[model samples]
Target: MAAADREFSPASSIALTVGSALLWGVAHLATGRRRIGLTLLGSYALLVATILSMVTLVGSDLLTLAVQPGWLTALTFMLLAIAAAWTVVIVWSYVLVRPDSSHPGRRIATIVAAVLCGLVVVPTVYAARLASVSRDVVTSLFTPSSAPIIADDPWNGRPRVNFLLVGADSAPSRPGVRTDSMTVASVDVATGATTLLGLPRNLQNVPMPPGPARQRFPSGFTGEPPYTPGLLNEVFQYAEDYPEVVPGVRKGYRGPTLLKETVGGILGIRIHHYAMVDMAGFAQIIDAMGGVRITIKDPIVYGKYREGLLPSGTRKLSGEQALWYGRSRTDSDDYVRMGRQKCLLNAVAKQADPMTVLNSFESLANATKRAISTDLPQNLLPAMVELAQKIKDTRIRSLNFVPPLISTAYPDYEFIKRKVEQTLADRPVNKTATAPGSRPQSTPQQSPERPLTLDEACA
Candidate 1:
């Protein structure tokens, strides 16, 4: 009799199909197709091992080496091709082990099994595509569009690592790109404690790096004589205008290096990296997470500088509203605007949880494509991921170098260093959240070193 006409055990047929679903070739091996089964088993094992290694090895340099876009794209397609083959194997296996031709509805049973095989394969294909898209986004945004001017080392031995986060403004009215908002995130490598220092755009006489620029501005950067004194924000654009000052900066990434060095000189510390976001593109990021909730302190106007868009209230603002709220300076000064930016930062830090990110991944990917740019290497991602989780419980402290605390015209660099040092050292041991319904001790003292609470600052 033919194989289809031969008497077959119902249990064995069911087991073969189900077994293939679980291990791709388990049923083949169980049914004594040892050579075919072993080949499949080896392939399955290799794929599983590679995936497990990538996910488990985050926060390590090893993770970076493996997850490059090229590798991920190749792996993604390979898995999909395997899934297609597996679907074929499942259907073929059932054909080989079918019940006798005399069995009732034999054709119907075969069709049902084939349908089931397609169901499993469809989702596997979809998942592979999603992973491919995610890898593409990371590679496009962070793979370094230009050769980086600076090099990075492990912060393992250092007490702290500092990063410059600049909000780049390239308004149509402006001559060139200006760093409208500049902040430094000095983080504790071991503890994950972070200190944020906001620098106002109007800050004057900001120091230059130790180069011809510094020698020229022995009294600090004051632009050129005909132009009069310039503000801190202009430092980057100024250096770009005259690259001769900081000779040998990377061909395309001149602004980041120049700005990073200027801030480092002003604060008197080694800045490890800089990540810049275009202000116009900032709206996309906020919109990706479906806009952010903020406490609107005052009416904010834009463009014509008329017609208020956001009235004072606690409400959810779209990307445009949030950007204006952060950028508005007509009703107030740059210092107050800087305070609002800090409040916005704290709100994002507390609200943008993991679930939100996972659900809105594609939207976030689009936003990142439009708004974000960073010098951070892909290899450092896994390590940063590990560090982020470790410090999830720690409170982030804010310190702005805005007015009343220190003169912007002539900042006390020594005092600024001391505050950064103090925040890093005297940081609360149990900075984690207190138990439910239990009020923590309140501090009667407040200084730039310990900025106002988010609510107070926004108010």
Candidate 2:
């Protein structure tokens, strides 16, 4: 009898069928179904060509596609289509190679083929789900804004773009949000060199920009009765309480918008975008990223009774430990914590590898969506992703407005702005003064006239 028409044992039939299905068309040719085998091969070739064309058009960096919602949505549909085609091929392969009815183990081979089809379906479904989740997160977080746009220049020809990053101490248990940590990440549009301008949360009398907010806090942001000693951190809560004072600002976003304007006014630059993440949910994100390694200079005592302690030295901390490392204030002061916060930020940025992110993406996505809010326009994401890639390799500098540099109690706004300008103009240093891999030995006591790179500040 011809090999193609011969009845094989169930074991042989199963092996040949499943293996050929994986190879896309080899099983059909083995079973005298050359027509179907060739068709599948041709279809697969076309699919590959279409995918290659897409990659060519989208640019070589596939990771950048994740940030583009429109492209991601299309990718989701394509993934489903590919999965469906694979299923059809697998089924066809099974039908072509199933043992004859007289074969005792025919039932077993049929059951195995169904299982193989299911195996093919599983991972593709998971991938499609991940794509869908990514799309939703991007769409929700970066809603299209009615903000004005420049036709020719996406960045409006700005040399640098500033983003206000806020760590908000707010939860359902808390009445209002406090800006626990605020840093302005200023990035050079062309080079991706970054300057992290850290602001003290307790900065008193922060000047408001010229508008309704400025009109209300004309003599600087002193508090209304019962909320005296108004600090910069309370700006958000204050804005929330009196929405009329921030007319034209969106209702749910008045606080962040006001904070943005206030921060911009303080720094003497326009804050292009703002993103805030809840302090309470901060640990979740760190956990999702599989925790972070930080160089702690000294033992930190935290909690109500100094019950918690994080020992010093280079250590990989869990999410909760990292949170306390950056937020603890029992023996540590805010200024010291602020420096730690900068170190923590730098560590997370540098250590979060693409493989880790991809492996923990689902958990990371959920945690991020629940914890963060931003006013960054959706249309800007692709450009932002490109900039981020640049930042990974570029120099990063940090300057915090703390005691000795500028008093939080009574800051010289003009001096601060001049310092900002000088730091921005300062050329990159060729060598770092600190030892390689050394943590910030002392709280960043940056010179009033000199700029401090992040590597030097928190090496």
lDDT of all predictions: 0.71, 0.81
Q: How many clashes in each structure?
A: 2, 1
Model 1 CA deviation exceeding 4 Å by range: 1-78, 94-119, 143-153, 224-229, 302-305, 427-449, 452-459
Predicted candidate 1 versus true structure: per-residue lDDT over 1-459, tens digit per residue: 643345556666666666776676676666667788788888778878876887787435444433456667776787688777778878867776666668765666577677768787887776677668778777876654343322244455677888898888776677788788999988887788777778888777676788788887876778766764587888878777887877888645776787888888777788988888887677787887888888876777755556556877889878787888888888688888877777876777667887777678778877777787777776566556656655566766677876566666656555556655666576432222332333342331134436543455555
Cα-based lDDT at residue 299, candidate 2: 94
How do the predictions measure up, each by TM-score? Answer: 0.77, 0.89
Residue-level lDDT of model 2, residues 206-253, one tens digit each, is: 777788877887878886656457889889998888988788777779
Give, for candidate 2, the lowest lDDT window spanning 10 residues. 428-437
Give the local distance difference test score of model 1: 0.71
Report model 2's TM-score to 2 decimal places: 0.89
